[model samples]
Target: MHTKASVQSVADTARGIVLATVEIAARPEHVFRALTEPDQVVRWWGSDEAYRMTNWEMDIGVGGHWRSEGRNADGTSFRASGKLRRVDRPTALSMSWMSDWDGGQASVVHYALEGTTRTTRLTLCHEELVDRPDACRAYAEGWRLVLGWLQQYLAPQSTEAFFLLRLNPPRPNFSEDMSSEEVALMKLHFGYWATLLQAGTAIAYGPVADPGGTWGVAIVRAAEMDAAWVLTDQDPVIRSGRGFRYEIFAMPQLMRGE
Candidate 1:
């Protein structure tokens, strides 16, 4: 019925453009929590397939730091960081948005709220987009997509299926004294992961943050293991140039939601 608010082109000035404000039905406080809380953000911030969010950190006060990373189905990641410039309890919030793609140039986002008896209106104003109009448009689209996702996320329905992919096969490589070549290679690997994160496919990942771990591990959830395999199956790290080897574990039910 299109009852859900539609994203409009409210104001597009000469250089700076104002995207249409989004109106959410939840309470102002609840919407603010979804925006600032780490777990809540991840749950609603991603697309349905080939896109997901992981590793979210948010500080809800002025001058606080906020960071989040998203992963794409291709096994790449993207990271963003910013400072909380303003917060007014449940009514309003403003933050600086910076990402690796733009080399840290910051954009400002302001969130405002209005409410009626049964519905609450959330108005988001993101401004000062510089250097990347594509990125800005993508983010604007993301907001519209996630609003619907958020409604589903907050619904009472349970997750249809859940499964874990325990790390298997070739062991991680590590050296107390890493060579320059190794360091460069590792950077390349990390950079790729970051790119995927921004695109919204990565589910969960880490580099063994603990002080005594032997290897890093990442867990990804996808439409199918075949898709997941396509992401990790061929790797310069795993294949040494000959190409990927190893039979993927078969688990049709997990992928099929049966």
Candidate 2:
């Protein structure tokens, strides 16, 4: 099972844009496919439980057009159409979006994806809403919900158990005086864990800022203790001969809620 997806929203009133970001447990190519492929879009585009996509068509290219039609639970129908402005496969896409609900009001939507082969960070920007602040907010929420559905749809199925990973370093004092090479390695270390977090292999990870010493912690999902060991042993810091080690504990009963 995967952890609850995290959605970050930023509304720039001056620019008339709503920005949303979420990390998905899949690669950029997979996420791009889900965004542009008609079948995948139908699966995760709507928020209402009873909402179902009735139609999906798209010509995926620079000047391609796309449209979708769906009905709400109450039998009310809605439609959306858009022209592809730009399409950079597996990385970015921009389109002009128009819907029937807003009296033909249109906006530009951009999706940007970045990450490694096992995880992706997706950023969505809905702009050109100069006179449609309400719609901007609504789209922000709607995108968040849709992304949640996407995450759930793409989450890796696992019958594995969970483990608590405690990271112990040689020393916990990280100050500005640290060597630049070590600092760079630490950044790589953080990046490594971030990929795991987005991949659902790690449920959560962070450094505990204790006054005595700062230690890292993570909750990992794995089939067994050896799998957990493999993950921790691959940490860049540990590989750098920095004397960082991990202690793994089996979590028999874990409770998580969103």
Q: Name the best candidate (by TM-score).
A: 2
lDDT of each: 0.59, 0.79
User: Against the hidden true structure, what lDDT does model 2 obtain?
Assistant: 0.79
Query: What stretches of model 2 exceed 4 Å from their correct place?
Result: 47-50, 156-258
Instruction: Give lDDT: candidate 2, residue 167.
Output: 83
What does the lDDT read for residue 213 in candidate 2?
79
Model 1 agreement with the true structure over 157-199: per-residue lDDT tens digits:
2222122333322333353555686566556655665665677
Per-residue lDDT, model 1, residue 72, is 77
Relative to the unseen true structure, what is the Cα RMSD of model 1? Answer: 15.7
Candidate 2 residues 37-109, lDDT tens each?
7756776666667577778898989999999899987989999899999999989999999998777888999
